[model samples]
Target: DQQVKQNSPSLSVQEGRISILNCDYTNSMFDYFLWYKKYPAEGPTFLISISSIKDKNEDGRFTVFLNKSAKHLSLHIVPSQPGDSAVYFCATQRGGSEKLVFGKGTKLTVNP
Candidate 1:
């Protein structure tokens, strides 16, 4: 069974708009939530993350919010740009585990 899920396979947004990507998980024991962005023909790169203990974490225009009670998390990008277009994956890891479970990914297109 897939532990993490990205309901939307793709999303489109106009340039400079705020983009929101959603993720859900079945495992409540996940201690960390991570978001990765992948460009074409490249490996996914770490984007933002939030610990289960915290509700939100932010870096530049990227922010990740975790809702433990709902087993849900979201990644938000403000002023979304064309360069931000990529496949975004939602991942989770346990406190002491190196193994990461990732969602299939959501393709984001920021139209210029």
Candidate 2:
């Protein structure tokens, strides 16, 4: 089963706070991991990604950490803004292709 799991259905945080989203996977063959941010009815857009070989990757206010041994990963957004309120999906790519298997998604609400 190629399933990525995001246990939390939603998260709420105050502005300028940190928003952390967690995800888990059962497949060990997955080598690439990605995080996508979505708003409303629009499609998810790429946020950040980390390979199995690395433990941490960061881009500006977004950071993603991966732990292959535990088959877990997390996304951290520091100083969250109102604009950060959206659905965050954790995805994984198996083998070589870029096709991704997504989690249920976590809705992040950053209150101003």
Candidate 3:
């Protein structure tokens, strides 16, 4: 059983619209949460991350929100483009640990 989970298997969003993805976890030891985007046949690429001590982190068109009390988090991509279509995985890193525990992932399709 994985500690990180993405309940939604897939998401569809129109281009230039906002896309939101959700994730949940059961591990309290995780001190950092990250979102990774992966294209077919390629490795996951880091999208955005948030520290457990903070509630939100934003970068360019990506934003990550953390809710420690609820053990939940979300990723938001504004003005999503067709190139944004990919599988997004929610992952966590334990304090002082380099290993990352990843969720099954949710496939996001950005329609043009």
Candidate 4:
């Protein structure tokens, strides 16, 4: 089946700390991986992405690592800020199109 899994429904961290979110997939055909962040009443916005050919990708305070052999991926946010408090969704796409299969989502809370 085409299922993306986010094991933890929520994570709490103090400001200026690092926040890590994990995702897993059962389908081997998934070649593109992406992370999206969402605020209340808003659609998810793309955070970071990595292709199956790459092991790591980073953008500013966000970094995404993909372990293709393990079919696992993770998103890391450094010096987590109050602005980072939101729902994070992990998504994967098959080789054909960019359509995504999303996880339930992980809520990240950054304490002041």
* RMSD of candidates 1 onward, in order: 0.6, 1.1, 0.8, 1.0
Model 2 lDDT at residue 99 = 82
lDDT of 2 by residue, 1-112 (tens): 5489999999999999999999999999999999999999898999999999999999999999999999999999998999999999999998877688999999999999
Q: Once all C-alphas are superposed, what RMSD does model 2 give against the true structure?
A: 1.1
| Best of the candidates, TM-score | 1
Higher-lDDT candidate among 1 and 2? Answer: 1
* Model 3 lDDT on a 0 to 1 scale: 0.95
**Model 2: pairs clashing at backbone N, Cα or C within 3 Å:** none
lDDT of each: 0.96, 0.95, 0.95, 0.96
lDDT of 1 at 99: 96
Each model's backbone clash number: 0, 0, 0, 0
Candidate 3 residue lDDT tens string, 35-58: 999999999998889998899999
**CA shift of 3, model 4, Å:** 1.1
Off by over 4 Å in 2: none
What does the lDDT read for residue 62 in candidate 4? Answer: 96
Report the lDDT tens digits of candidate 1 across residue range 79-102: 899999999999999878999999
Alpha carbon deviation, residue 68, candidate 1 (Å):
0.6
Candidates 3 and 4 compared: the better one by lDDT is: 4
For all predicted structures, in order, the TM-scores are 0.98, 0.96, 0.96, 0.96
**How far does residue 94 in candidate 2 sit from its true spot (Å)?**
1.0
